[model samples]
Target: MHRLAPLVFPAAGTRHTATVIFAHGLGDSGHGWAAFVENWRRRQRLDEVKFVLPHAPEIPITVNMGYKMPGWYDIAALGLSAGQLRENEDEAGLLESREYFQKLVQQEIDSGISADRIVLGGYSQGGAVALFTGLTSLVKLAGIVGMSTYLPLSLKLESTYIPKPASANVNAQTPIIMCHGTADPVLPYQLASMSRDHLVKLGYPVEWKEYAGMPHTVLPEELDDVEDFLRKVLPPSADGKTEL
Candidate 1:
């Protein structure tokens, strides 16, 4: 697999072992979540955790009338005005994205980090892709953390996702944490719930949380939840499993 240039944020003391690759939302750079990441870095004392943020390549967005933007895939229409905005299904683009991030995961594994110690996470559009890729991952990741995100390729997941023999039944393994705002205007709450339910019906380990009155953004409480999740998934050290 080729290399992907990602914004690297090492542990509090330059320690490296655990890995977390976080993608940014549409039209936003990988650094878009810098401040949010800083909050977690300061609050958590994970000296061995390494954070990777990958910037999305610029692409034409259908909803924006083919205007170029940094998006994982083209959005056909927002359907907001007519309540019919829908993501443009780009099979090639989505598959390309999955390959790119999959390399990042393999990179960490090749560098001595165990597959189970690597976490995949993102926000909004990034979160959606993370779910799409992480769920279909051949290697079992520590967990998947998606905020304001929904499952993509719902119809194709079962058939397209190539799983390892050990992961033939992914429903019971590979825990997932999905958070959304009940009052979200961009990605409606119902859609998020539907995505969660879809996974639940498929028997995936999915945890859905709703934030009251929140919009298409993250809240402090939501950040807290993410931090809590990270702590629970990654061990503090190779031999130490205390606070993370």
Candidate 2:
């Protein structure tokens, strides 16, 4: 299994009830999301939530001129060819990435947070991984937050990997939030809609949000929405009224 170096952020308070595993976009490390948590701490004064960011191993993206960068998969082309951009499916790297992610989750569980109290989220390619891991895992988590990412080919609703809605082992009812920018050039906004439709068909409760006139990047309002969703899905306190 591939090893990942993760940055962990423990809640400022004495007790932590929730954990947010943050994954970064393509070519970015887990440290990329550090600023978001820093800002969150200052603004909300939330000290009871833990954050973990894991870095993806360096890999080559065929579509990006075979440049070696931090990528979850290799895209062979810039155009929309079906199999051209999906060379990562046959590679062992993605499976390794999944194992690395699983280890990260286990590390969190070892730290005292229950698996049910964990929320997984990410941006772009990282978001795709988070969604893939959250849904396919046997463990049911608190929620999943996918920002500017499309569902992975492995879990493509049209493929043979259809998830059983009535299965007692799967968390078919897990809440998922997908946020996309209408003008995102990297991953088209339509993919987000398709993902939402697919999840709904699979009986997963998903919240889809499109930011009009936004680009292929995270906006302040988008982060706010993520924060709010996290708070609602993973309440920091038992009373559920804790600010931030």
Best by TM-score: 1
Total clashes in model 2, counting residue pairs 3 or more apart in sequence or in different chains: 3
For model 1, residues 118-203, the per-residue Cα lDDT tens digits are 99999988998899888888777899999997777777777766464644644247889999999888888887888899898877
Task: For candidate 2, write residues 87-188 as lDDT tens digits.
Answer: 445335555666667777787777667788888889988898788878876677889999998777645533433345547436577789999999877777
Best by lDDT: 1
Error of 2 at 203 (Å): 1.0
Query: Where's the lowest-lDDT run of ten residues in candidate 1?
Result: 79-88
In candidate 1, list every pair of residues with a backbone clash.
Answer: 76-88, 78-85, 79-84, 79-85, 171-203
**Against the hidden reference, what TM-scores do the models get?**
0.89, 0.87
